[model samples]
Target: MRPLDPRLLRYAAGARWFFAAGAVLAALQTVLTIAFAWSLSQAIVGVVEGRSLAELRTEILVFAGTTIARLVVTWASGSVSIRGAARVKSELRSRLYRAIGRLGPAWSAGRSSAGLTVLGTRGLDALDDYFGKYLPQLILTVIATPVIVAVMFWQDVLSGVFVVVTLPLIPVFMVLIGWATQSVQRQQWDTLSELSGNYLDVLGGLSTLKSFGRAERQLTRIRVVTERYRVATMKVLRTTFLSGFALELGASLSVALVAVGVGMRLVAGDIGFGPALFVLLLAPEAFLPLRNVGTNFHAAAEGVTASEDVFAILDEAADAADATATAVHPGGGPSSAATAPAGLEFHDVGVSYDGTTVLSGVSARFAPGRVGVLTGPSGSGKSSLISTLLGTVAHDGVLTLDGSPLPSGPGERPWLAWSGQRPGLISGTVADNVSLGEASVDPDRLTRALALAQLDGWDADRECGVAGSLLSGGQAQRVAVARAFYRALRPETRVLVLDEPSSALDHETERRLAASITELAAGGLVVIVASHRRRLRDIADVELALTPAVAKR
Candidate 1:
């Protein structure tokens, strides 16, 4: 990991302010350090020379005052660094969330949600040690170490040379130790993410495992993963302790070298007692910042690793944005215009994944005031087509609305409302889930949408619990469909797409949903339903059948 990542400054504006404040504090502390060392040295020498107490009074007070000021500066520096870290973490997290949203469901489908949860929460929290300790010491090292060494040089050339030569040794040892620490720290972080992901997976599918009499096997699996994580953590801790000891030893030896030189000069009368004393005092101060930096780096290594993960995500988002901007649309024009026709058209649209075609050369159109049903066998590209329409997947050919190309970014497709195979319901009241994106719930629309989805007379205030656990499977599915219905109620919504809306419902409820879909189409909206039910296909004003594309060898 870099001593400081440039991406942190680029992504978190607050980090810039933190650096500024830290530098100011470090400079002030350095000045006070010099003042304190000088005053104390002079006072001690004056007493040894048999000077009167009154003569040494000013020197005594100067050192005392400088000591107090140094304490205040240290406290203030810590406070500033902590607050700055909070702001930076907050900013980075917010940006990370936005980037994920932009990447959309397609990008996230291949990633572990549990791992991301760990990263956004506990992983980023590790930065507390980074900004609070490591960065402050680093700034001090840059601003104070050289200044102290220069002062030593001015007083005694031999002592200054010793400092300059030995200071490099601490950094050299730090580099070697840091490499090992980073390798171990990264392993620990990965293990933690894997543990979180596996644990979440086991929980999510515990019911299925129990049904198959295999739940006990999962316990063993989790135990093994837990042990692996424990071992990884121990390795990281071992590396940290060993690296800390190495840095302390190097700093101690360097300070001793300077101390021995000063002691010899004083014995030989080659330097004044006051100058020798001052050099002796400043020698440790010169090494203090560098030594602290090495110690704090290990503590902050985890945060550095997390930041690297965050930067990778941010870079992916940036690259995706660039690709979106430069990509060519098949229709060769801007997105749908306000005056365009109220219908959707597919011009030989195709989709591929990992160089294997899933959809190819399919053409179709659905006009307003029509119920269009897509029927196909498994692996027939039905979901792929919907993904392309939702702007979650890239496709060949063109999808147009009212004769204009459809926008390829999800955020730009505000006119489309959809419900997928998964309920994806959050913990909230029924009304809250239905009117999710609305600024405020419209009571009339909420009641109508629920009624249209065969949820009429159901309490709007019914709790969904976690992932709609409070509702039955069919009810949760309806709630998801109702959410899409709620969105379709908006005047701006032109198309409503539902994937397997009736898969969990009984025959009677499926018939009612089909009638409701027909009613929606009557309102001059293009309604598309992807399903295998014969009743739904019979009610459609149009039907499009898709076949799986042949893979090229």
Candidate 2:
């Protein structure tokens, strides 16, 4: 389903009542405002006809009372509208993040970080007007504008028709300009989103670029992106300026026509001077709201454009889908946490993406007390098989643990420990990265896991530096693996899946990793590692090489 617009109604439904009340007040203000103008005409006409001073005082009192009341109601309505808008923007951002969460990694990989960011910052921002200004103004246009026209018509139907006719011109010109700029605005939004992503990437890779002595080259690339963003922004601005000019000119010309008509009618003695003057005065106010609507809507365009991505994210399939719950350990066995007693088993499990096969019909078992090692070439579907075992990837074929089919989709799992080639670390002390959500690791367990992962030297008290800037490749990689081991270390953890365990490690580090694997396997842990490092073979019992055919295409 298409996602809901980031709107106020979703957050503070109670505020919707306030918005309604505000619209009503705004409508009343419109009538009083016009009535105050009429009263002025009355007071002026009465005074000119040699009315008494006391009558003039009463006339002035009426104008003051009505105008002041109108201002109060208008202010009250504006307050409600603004509050509603602010609340909706905040709620919508939270909703967007929530939606992104639902879709999981498979779904998230398809979207750009820059696009998601724009949706959060700009997309939610659009709701400000969607709730506060555009909506209220639109409501006023629907309820108040007509009432204004009716009052004008009551005094002089011809003037009423003249005022009503001007209303269509403002929107007609606006829509015409809107059509012309729609494509440009879309292009501008795309450019802005891409620019945000590029900038974020550059900043993220700044250190890496500097290390490679390519920071200057990246800076030049960033300058190019900045110039592109500027050009796109200027294009949108030019079009917006043209649109405003058209709307302004159209509204002004139409109001001027009303004035000329009222003047001509009064000169022809078709109506009294007082009524004609009233019609002339009220004509401009009727069209002002519509013109304002166009301008305010223009301001909202950026928000609206950015909100599309937010909406898309909200509509995405969640990260924790039920269809992706089952996991298989790299030993080609069902998740060990399975309690059914059927034990973990993988029967001809296979997986493919975009017609390119990653894992093919393979059968294996990881019943407790048996440790299985998955050994193969770099692209031999070893890691892909591990992903299926970890329930991180959707796959084809049957996986059963303890005799029952494994859960296939969504939600956090309690039993698995799978680490990828490059593990991520959040900003915090070393202790925080190691536990993730796992309870505080005991000092002994922490030390042992760190030693096994070859990161025993890291001080728990030091800051990890945004993604652990202080850690070397081996350290970071080991830290990631240690997190899995420490996070609820199931000594009986049925399957331990490792992808490229020795990718960047030196011989000594690789030796330590192999020793850790051997110890874990000897303890009846079914361990699987994707490795080209033959040193791993010392600890591995079964070497399974996934041929291109074995892993599908």
Candidate 3:
């Protein structure tokens, strides 16, 4: 709600230049306004004093020149503001995306992806009105209002006093109206985000809903959310119209007061006609900037709301980064790439969510060239432990590799490979999915990975459709596992983690996957698998059992 947020300058470099340009243009515009008013007043008074048109040609030409200059300046200001808005929007979107990536999947798990999509797209686009209309007028208000009032005071103290006293009334009314507008605008924004999230959820689960004969029920839910958004939008528009009327009325009456005072003084011969006319002309100019600011503020409120949300996310990412930087290492220093670990070890690691401990005081080590299996009942923290190793979940105790402390987060752990329970595949060919994150797909590695995942002779050119819809449940699961295998085949990858890789496979396919995991361990990789399948535990060189704990809701 601020006229300008300091964080906008911090996040978008273009904003700094925009403010600089706006100030220059605003100052130029103010000077031209004063010049045009004085020139026109002098021309009128000279003609009334019996001077010919040719005798007053200088004042007439000056009036026309200032008018043209003002027009050019206005156009230039608009062009600069538009380009600046585009640059700021692009920068904000890019920074927001990078921050989300750094926060990782664990941080995003509890958030709504559809809401975020709306924020990055439609929400930020609202800033067009803010930068183009509201901010320029704000700059003018700061630069033009004071100077015009000073000119008025120089001409006549009574008119200047009237302006100074009544100018504050517009802002007083503006503050009251702005408070109401902000409340309704924020409600509208939230309802829009809700509507987007609900629609996305229905679309994503449409097949399952149809299978249960409950697809029609989702239509009612969507309709309810859409109606809520529509009502919220109408409320915002209502407030905007009412607030605009209030501002216009206040400005008009204030101008009328100045005009009435000037006319009476001119008739009584207490003030010269030229000075009276000049004071009257400058009266509206003094109030114009403030009035425009109040009117455009409502239009820009939504962008202001969206920017606040963006700043919140950016701040959270920064705080997370700071905490990670100050984290204590077991070895008293971070491990270097030259001192890469030969094994993975957990020394009393624990994980918690909302003050409820899910895994506590668990310790284990899986050496290179060995397969380690984690066995536990549901909600016993099998996946939680895997999350700690993946650097997605914060842990209570130290995690070290070959007696050296591991770096925080997956971005720092290029030597690790993992596949979760979900396929997480995009629309692409099988080869593209298998060789993800690589600059170029290596056909040899792609074929070998698919073969190891028991997908031998599968089409590398086959499409997976959206979220791997073209593939069966078993096929999608294998493709996800193959993605891990493809990464594990790299020379630098030292550890491989799989969370329920065989959940969707039959007994024969599970056996083949177990043999593949054993083969990977034999090739000097530390393979860790979290599953309840007895066959997977049978192939492990080390087995860790987790006991379930009561979780507070």
lDDT of 1 by residue, 364-472 (tens): 8899999999999989999899998888877778888887777775566678999999999999999989998668999999999999999999999999998998999
Q: TM-score of each candidate?
A: 0.96, 0.81, 0.92
Candidate lDDT scores, in order, read 0.90, 0.71, 0.90
Candidate 2 lDDT (Cα, 0 to 1): 0.71
Q: Which TM-score value belongs to model 3?
A: 0.92
For every candidate in turn, the CA RMSD to the true structure comes to 1.9, 4.9, 2.7
Ranking by TM-score: 1, 3, 2
lDDT of 1: 0.90
Model 3 per-residue lDDT tens digits across residues 375-400: 98998999989988777777677777
**Residue 96 lDDT (model 3):** 94
Model 2 lDDT tens row, 1-553: 1112434354446556756676677778787878788888888888879898787887788899998897787778778877877766666677767666555455567778777777688767766665566666766776767777887899898878877766787877777777766667777788877788888888888889999998888777778878988888888788878888888888889889888888888888998988887777777778777777777666666666666655555545433343345433343444445444534567677777657777777877665444456776666777777766665566777777566666554445565677888778888877788877755558887777777777778687667767767777777777788876664256546666787767778998888778877776666656676777778866666667676654335
Best by TM-score: 1
Angstrom error of the Cα, residue 248, model 1: value is 1.0
Stronger candidate by lDDT (1 vs 2): 1
Q: After superposition, how far is residue 102 of candidate 3 from its true place, in Å?
A: 3.8
Q: Rank the candidates by lDDT, best first.
A: 1, 3, 2
Instruction: Give the lDDT of residue 112 in candidate 2.
Output: 85
